[model samples]
Target: MDDFYSKQSPFNPDVKSFRFYKNGNLKIELKTKEDAEKVARLLLP
Candidate 1:
């Protein structure tokens, strides 16, 4: 699942950078909240 995100997003060190839960929820830990939101929008349905 993490590997899928790494391939989709530009962010590196995917495991440390992003977290995806089983309920289709996304938690992104990064300096740029805006960037995280962008990725989240793309990811979420």
Candidate 2:
């Protein structure tokens, strides 16, 4: 399963900085820890 495909919650970006909240528009339930890491990597990449 090396070819993994992951997607982001659409409202993830609109989230306030330094504040954590669940995105209301995604089709999947993205955990806070997972979302934070994903968003961090996306921005830093």
Candidate 3:
């Protein structure tokens, strides 16, 4: 997850932080709900 964040964050400054859980859940913190939704869409398969 750290590698993914490091590579992706440079292109997205709005992404403030991220957490990956053992239960296969990822939590991403962005500047706004809209931005979060956009990132989620981009990350989803």
Top model by lDDT, which number? 3
Clashing pairs in 2: none
What is the C-alpha lDDT profile of model 3 across 1-45, one tens digit per residue?
Answer: 343423124336787767666566666678888987887799898
Question: 1-45 in candidate 2: lDDT tens per residue?
Answer: 222244433565544333223443333344577676776798795
Report backbone clashes per prediction: 0, 0, 0
Ranking by lDDT: 3, 1, 2
- My TM-score estimates for the predictions, one after another, are 0.34, 0.31, 0.46
Model 2, stretches more than 4 Å misplaced?
1-31
What local distance difference test score does each model get? 0.56, 0.48, 0.65
How far residue 24's Cα lies from its native spot in candidate 3, in Å, is: 0.8
> Alpha carbon lDDT of residue 38, candidate 2?
77
Instruction: Report the CA-based lDDT of candidate 1 relative to the real structure.
Output: 0.56
Residues 1-45 of candidate 1 have per-residue lDDT tens digits of 343233234356533355556666666665666766876898899
TM-score, model 1 to reference: 0.34
Error of 1 at 6 (Å): 13
Worst 10 residues of 1 by lDDT: 1-10
